[model samples]
Target: MARKRGLGRDDVVTAGLAVLDHAGIDAVSLAAVAERLDVRPPSLYAHVDGLAGLKRDLAHTTTVEFGEVLRDSVLGRSGPDAVRSFADAYRRWATGFPGRYEMTLLPIAADDDERRAGARLALGAVQAVIRGFGIDETSAIQAGRSLRSALDGFSRLENADNMGRGDHDADFAFLIDLLIDGISQAGTQPPGPA
Candidate 1:
């Protein structure tokens, strides 16, 4: 109970993530994390402000972690290939860590710079795909929003086992192809008279 040598904020975050993985978001409490770390609850206050602070940290950490997953997935890919890789990476992460994935969507204030940047990093992955499609800045924002929404909706449904029983893998592949095709066509479309 001597502060557990080498224990730090990252350790707390890792412990919290473990709790999240095993028992869901609601199970991630200071006491739970402390217990996981073999320390008392008050000891956690030294590493994290409190439950709210811990959750905030967890949100930022997980957002970045999710973004890293995305970025890594498309490291050598571009265009429709990046799109497919991004989609596959996202679904795998969402389904693998449903609790943490939900935390990524939690509402946070705009002033939360670290959290905002982490979230943006994840979105940046999608923007990379949009960029591959040659979409301009004006169109990229809208395109990113649509792609994120579609991916989130599909992942949530698929994670909840609500995607029906007709080979979900194929369903996801088809969905990705449809998204890529849509983006490809949009890129080729002549701009409307303006």
Candidate 2:
């Protein structure tokens, strides 16, 4: 019979996410998680290589969770309806889980499993949106980048409490509508000047 691992990697990752959700990313150290789990800091090495590894895993986990939210929100929808749903989900995820949402801004690296996982999750969300418009892969990627930029910008601003006074919800809605119009135009635009 195989010996059971005391603190599985997934458990550590999950705990790390909890730490992130409750506190900010900076508070999620192996020692911190160890304290939360009532284990020695050294014991965490068996489950996670180090703090960096934990951060990577947390990023991967956050992305996967975000992907599920997007999938559920955008499925069976199309056109502006899908776009609006996706945008709302994205904003909700960001506002609801600020620390996890901040992980999306981390720089991706080659040869990193977490990076691949994060990419997969992000791409899955984009594909969900792309499917709504029946866009090709190239166009989908472009549109995805645009949508991500817009959402990220708005969320970051809001999280920083820089949205400024006067009906932020109205402003957010207008931005979403603008993005939908932009995406629609891009979908129908002809290639290059004649």
Candidate 3:
């Protein structure tokens, strides 16, 4: 029994990630994780509050990991170069870790520490690109939203196999370039449109 009960919370999360990767989000459950760990369903309660809690924790973990990829890819880069790098990294991370990447999109409430750390990681990536334009904090935040939306939209579309006709990579590159140019022009534009 001691050997059978050796599983821990991290073990449950690890098993959950495996289930997510092998199957899909819908397939991950407390029972599934327990089965993977060869433990009783009740055993999970000691680790995760419930399925929602487990999923939230997984999402948070995945987001942090994704943020690290963005950080590493965009660091020390600037301007359009940084933008392209960040965009490419985002796509790559999502493609490479589809299960984990999907988790990042799930809406979940995070504690202060999780929220702050995740925000810093996410903002740090955005700031890397925005800093290139010498944008202010407010503008940086706005640009970050735009950047995230574009990347998220593109990744979601691609994941769904929704690209219609053109070459996906070429189209993605074009969009990234367009976004970089748009941000640059926005920086130079007057407060209001003419």
Off by over 4 Å in 2: 1-6, 113-118, 134-140, 192-194
Question: How many angstroms is residue 57 displaced in model 1 relative to the true structure, after the best TM-score fit?
Answer: 1.0
**Model 1 steric clash pairs:** none
Please report how far candidate 2 places residue 30 from its true position, in Å: 1.4
- Candidate 2 matches the true fold with a TM-score of 0.85
lDDT of 3 at 182: 77
Best by lDDT: 1
* Candidate ordering by TM-score (highest first): 1, 3, 2
Q: Report lDDT per candidate.
A: 0.86, 0.80, 0.81
Residues 69-128 of candidate 1 have per-residue lDDT tens digits of 998888878998899899999999999999899999899677899888887778778878
Cα-based TM-score, every candidate: 0.89, 0.85, 0.88
- Specify the highest-TM-score model's number: 1
What is the C-alpha lDDT profile of model 2 across 120-169, one tens digit per residue? 76677677776677655566677778898999899889988898898877
**lDDT: worst 10-residue window of model 2:** 185-194
lDDT of 3 by residue, 34-139 (tens): 8888777877888898998789778777778887888988877889989998999999888766788888777646563784577578778888888899765666
